[model samples]
Target: DTAVSQTPKYLVTQMGNDKSIKCEQNLGHDTMYWYKQDSKKFLKIMFSYNNKELIINETVPNRFSPKSPDKAHLNLHINSLELGDSAVYFCASSLSGTQYFGPGTRLLVL
Candidate 1:
């Protein structure tokens, strides 16, 4: 069983195409988040939700959106992707201060 899973470990596509990365967590946590890890390994918070309601939006572009069907799943969708959008997307959850992360989904734009 996977604690967290994100589809398409690597994605490469044209700049204008729309794409999505699915994420899920089974740790019974109430809060889940989407983060982007840049080439420097600095994890920046993009969005977060608790009980299916958004709790954080850290200056992320409107072209990027996140959806949570339930407490266990959070998915990201990007529209009209740009070359600057190329980065590693990660899903994470936290109960207190401890956070658990997914392997990450790498996106490349050409």
Candidate 2:
């Protein structure tokens, strides 16, 4: 089984629409992060949760939030999507010094 997984592998929505990407980890890591990769392939961490509790929140827009239902799951929800929001979103979990990433969710805002 994959260590990390995400749902809605591909999402296409309008600029003002709302969407979500679900992520789950089976590695039993305590820390999970939501990252965004732009067209330039610049990856940036948007949110971080430890044990299902948010611990690190970067300068992400207020419309973006991380919802964790359990220690093994951390989902990303975005409201009022924009064209600039079109990118590949990744979910990752880390333990010790190694990080495991999901297959990634590609989101496109028309």
Candidate 3:
């Protein structure tokens, strides 16, 4: 059984489009995170949710939003997508600071 899963693993869209990604974890972890991997393979945390409260990374833009309705699910929404926003988005669940990542959702902005 998969510990973490993401829906619509691939997305292709035009610039200025809005998109959302869904994630769920069965590990019963209290903390979940969203990460972005750029073309250069630099991975950075965008947002984290602990017990349904959000903790966003300061460097992340307001256009990126993360919502966690419960401990087992976290979803990401991006408004006005740009070319630079094209990247692999990963969802992770952590217990005691050790994280397990889901298969990434690759978004391509044309």
Among the numbered candidates, top lDDT falls to 2
Q: In candidate 1, residue 16 scores what lDDT?
A: 96
Compared with the true structure, all predictions reach lDDT values of 0.93, 0.94, 0.93
Question: Which pairs clash (backbone N, Cα, C closer than 3 Å) in model 1?
Answer: none
lDDT of 1 by residue, 1-110 (tens): 88888897999999899999999888998899999988788889999999999999999999999999999999999999999999999999878878899999999999
**TM-scores, all models, native as reference:** 0.96, 0.97, 0.96
Task: Point out where model 3 deviates above 4 Å.
Answer: none
Question: How many collisions per candidate?
Answer: 0, 0, 0
lDDT of 3 by residue, 1-110 (tens): 89999987999999998999999999999999999999999999888899999876658778988888899999999999999999999999999989999999999999
Candidate 2, residue 25: how far the Cα is off, in Å: 0.7
* Residues 1-110, model 2: lDDT tens digits: 88899998999999999898999999989999999999999999899999989999999999998999998999998999999999999999999968899999999999
User: How well does candidate 2 score on lDDT at residue 11?
Assistant: 97
Q: By summed lDDT, which 10 consecutive residues of candidate 3 come out lowest?
A: 54-63
Residue pairs in candidate 2 whose N, alpha carbon or C atoms collide under 3 angstroms = none
